[model samples]
Target: MQTFHLDAISQDRQTLAEPYHEFLRTRDMSAGVYHMEPGSHDPQGAHQEDVLFYVIRGAATLRVGDDELEVGAGSIVHVPARVAPRFVAVAEAIDVLVVFAPAESAPTIEVKYTA
Candidate 1:
């Protein structure tokens, strides 16, 4: 039984960008906590593996393909592999638990975001 706590993950002070403290990452999946301050947003990028973004606190907007949707606390957004989706932290210092799986085996795709 593997057990862990988010408190054990310390706040990142090295950079000005949103803090990302990786807890665990195996050959099959990866997990981490992302903290973004108010008006701050993470880059809209694409990856190869399928991803699930779970909102732990606050609200955000998710862009999947040509569609844009709003998500908040307790909300989960599942993104399919090979698809480029972007997530923006809209509310004050949103915290998100992101998980990526399949060990990044899929092919990468281009993602474009518009305001």
Candidate 2:
């Protein structure tokens, strides 16, 4: 029983491994909005929890293990637990809505460059 407004959360950008606005976190799942600048790439790594990336704006190439694809607005990508993924060759700055199931406590790797 919680709610969030994207416009409100996106207004303030923070500096970290990846600039994001974390809006929800519970025992079962967690969610956030991530903003990436053009030419910025995410660090290569994996997570213990399954993750979903919903592209809200712009375009980029996502590499999930041995596979790669061009993703843009309206695209949805899923990465299973323990599968390393990376975002590269960003044609345009992108906004993504990210979610993880079984809520990830922290990154398995030392550095994670995305939400």
What TM-score would every model get versus the actual structure? 0.77, 0.86
Candidate 2 C-alpha lDDT tens digits along 1-115? 7778778778754543447677889999998888888877686588788989999999999988777999999999989988877787789988999898988766555334454
lDDT score of residue 18 within candidate 2? 49
Off by over 4 Å in 2: 14-18, 110-115
RMSD of each: 3.8, 4.8
The per-model lDDT (C-alpha) reads: 0.72, 0.81
Candidate 2, which ten residues in sequence have the lowest lDDT sum?
106-115
The stretch of ten residues in a row with the least summed lDDT in candidate 1 is 9-18
lDDT of 1 at 59: 76
Superposed on all Cα atoms, model 1 deviates from the true structure by an RMSD in Å of 3.8
Which candidate's lDDT is highest?
2
